[model samples]
Target: MNFLTIFARNLKQGPQTEAFPLGPAFTPERLRGRIEFNADHCEGCRICERVCPANAIRFAKTPDGMTFDCWHNTCVFCGNCEFYCPTDAIHQTNDWDLSHVNADKFDMVEHGLIPNQKCVECGATALNTAPVIKNAKPPLSAEEYTELRARCPKCRAKYLKNRKVPA
Candidate 1:
């Protein structure tokens, strides 16, 4: 088409683009935007940390509990953490407006307090995190259930070995 014809057609269809920052912003469905972490649902699995392509997720072990930190600036919006999280703790929301002056503000940190089960024999701490207790499988007897409660792996092994019953 000629320049005049194209110009007239364009003039007839005015403001083709959506007005953003002035009006409502539109994001596509199933868009992976930002990371939303629910500490209550988390079991300290660390699967999200291992699967993160951007290395945005960091796990810090504290005396009381562990902390999960995610930096938005480093995140590539790939939704790897959300997919890898078994507990459905990490989710990718549709809020993509992550602009910030101070980068520290974009850092989201979730702290989870996981109580270690003390070994009955040596009184040592167990390595099992939240998921172990929450997602415990059944078919275990009362004695087995009690035994699986909190003892460290080493002590649990020894305890199991001494027991007449096989776990």
Candidate 2:
């Protein structure tokens, strides 16, 4: 009984361990989580692929063997690729929203894009890529067209024909 008490007291001399989740999650400001990417900055160089420990990042090659991908889910957050990026295209973010209910969500594409779409101006599928911006001018507000005799009969007839009804 005497030996047990002394042994227990000595063991407890160190700091008490705090309970995680309930107490506090141990993390830091610089803790790495999800990998970040800049599509325009990426030069399609495979330097990141060669150095990845987890084989997380990969390239989605086109038929002509052009790379256009930056997979984030399989990435291990080792920061090796981020450190070695010459173009500064890839970096690590603190985001931890990698959880998904569907298993299909984890089947990430290298660039995570839906291909084969037409470019508005060119009308070709070649320019199909991520985050397309329609460069066309925004529809003019009604108040913006408040003017007297803005156009001749020919122009007014065409404009009236294109006007949408409230119904």
Candidate 3:
């Protein structure tokens, strides 16, 4: 067809696109757009730290506590961390509104993680105060080697509660 004829045909057809920043839009179901972490469920094994292909995931710990960084700007979203998580802690949420004006704001947090809260039950240390272990597996498994992994005596008893009433 001639250039003029083609141009006229194109102009006759309406724009087939969605308007943005003015109307509510729908994100596709299969479209991957964001990552999320549940800090409470995070046992700080840092398997996510190990499996990340982009080197975007990082962790830091002092005598203080632990924190995780998704670094979404650099993350390729391979979901390596999500699959490798033994305890099913780090997984993606369906909230994909991640366009941020500030570069640092892309750091999506589990937020309200109490890194400084003291262990009220024991004078020793709480999950909040300290997160990671110096050695990966201890001789005692923190408190004891149980079927459920590294759970302290007090925590275990609370978990394995007596459902049956004793006469």
Candidate 4:
């Protein structure tokens, strides 16, 4: 209980913590660490971004395409993105060592050129998302759905404007 005794004991025990950053880092099983996005499997539903509690997930629709970004600094690692991803594109990895001096290290972003389906009517780019085009098979016939999927935004607007609805 003496100060000298305590100091001696501390000296004898040395460091009680693991030497991380120099040695192997350990993470717990099922550690919701970093968010991983698989663009191949992603349907761009934006559901993950919508369901994120921390607002760490962000989506931007640019001229090039839609980009999804996740910030580790803002993320609480709750795995909400993974849970809400309808396409199973988002995943929680076991890499919990997120420490870094540079703030840019915390950013995870995925960007790709928009997959445009040409409008069958005018050969213009279709405004529908990939998932929408893929899932548009049941109600509309195959040919009609294909044409609809290829319809451009301008053409769609014009069609809607000229459409006659029965009272």
Candidate 5:
């Protein structure tokens, strides 16, 4: 077509670009964006840290407990850490709005803490994470699960071992 004809046709159609800043931007359902960490559901396995290709995730021992940090600046949004986490503690949210000034670059981090708790039976301190109980015979009752959560690893194993299985 001629330039004038093509220009007329283009003018008839509205702007094809997204109206972001004036309207909500398009976000896909599976868009890999910001990282989120939930210490409560974490198993303290540190698999997320090892799987992160960008080395954005780090775990450190602190006086209070273990601390988790994921730097957004360094993260490539590969979702490897989220996929490798066995307990679903790490997740990638759809909020991809990471625009920030130079001053705020260092603050773009997702942080979490797995606090230490005293074992009810052994008086030992351990991370307050959900116990990994995949092989409980008839499934643990709420009370039994609560009791299991209150002990150390060794005591929890013992409790599970001594549990009377129903016929």
Candidate 6:
């Protein structure tokens, strides 16, 4: 085909690129974009930190409790942390708009804190996270669950072991 003919065809087709900034960008359902952390659902396990290849996830001990931080700048978005989290505490969101200036680079972090709480029985300080009751044969009732959440890991284990099953 001649140049004029090709040019005419291209003009008729118009702009082939997406109208980003003016319109919303296409985000896939499974697109791994940003990291999200939920301290309430966390089991106080550091599996996500271990599985993160980029060393983006970090757990630090503070006076109040343990703090979790995921640095977006360092994160490779591999989704390893989300996959290895047993309690589904860490997951990825589809919002990929991470554009930022040089001044805001350090602020691009996902942070969460697991606050310390006193165990009802032992008075020992423990992270106020959801209790892991995987071994509980009979699902815990509302009252039982409330009691379980007030104890430390050791106390929780003992309570579960000594729980009397109703006939």
Candidate 4 lDDT (Cα, whole model)? 0.68
TM-score of 2: 0.45
Tens-digit lDDT string for candidate 5 (1-167): 59999899889996889989899999999899999999988888899889888899999999899999999999999999888888888999998999999999999999999888899998999878778877778899989988988888899989999999989
For each candidate in turn, the TM-score is: 0.61, 0.45, 0.55, 0.58, 0.88, 0.88
Colliding pairs, model 3: none
User: 1 or 6, which is superior by TM-score?
Assistant: 6
Error of 5 at 24 (Å): 0.7
What's the lDDT for residue 109 in model 5? 94
Clash-forming residue pairs, model 4: 119-150
Better of 3 and 4 by lDDT: 4
Clashes of 3: 0
Best-to-worst order by TM-score is 5, 6, 1, 4, 3, 2
Note the Cα lDDT for every prediction shown: 0.70, 0.56, 0.59, 0.68, 0.90, 0.91
Candidate 3 TM-score to native = 0.55
- What lDDT tens digits, residue by residue, belong to model 2 across residues 82-117? 898776778887766566667756555445332343
Model 5 scores worst on lDDT over the 10 consecutive residues at 127-136
Q: Counting only residues 3 or more apart in sequence or on different chains, how many pairs clash (N, Cα, C under 3 Å) in candidate 4?
A: 1
Mark the regions of model 1 whose C-alpha exceeds 4 Å error after superposition.
1-14, 103-129, 132-167
Which pairs clash inside model 1?
Answer: none
Q: Tens digit of lDDT per residue, candidate 1, span 85-137?
A: 77788889888787766756744543344454567767886544533433334
lDDT at 30 for candidate 3? 60
Q: How many residue pairs clash in each candidate?
A: 0, 3, 0, 1, 0, 0
Which residue window of length 10 is worst by lDDT in model 3? 129-138
Q: Residue 111: error of model 6 in Å?
A: 0.8
What local lDDT does model 4 show for residue 8?
100
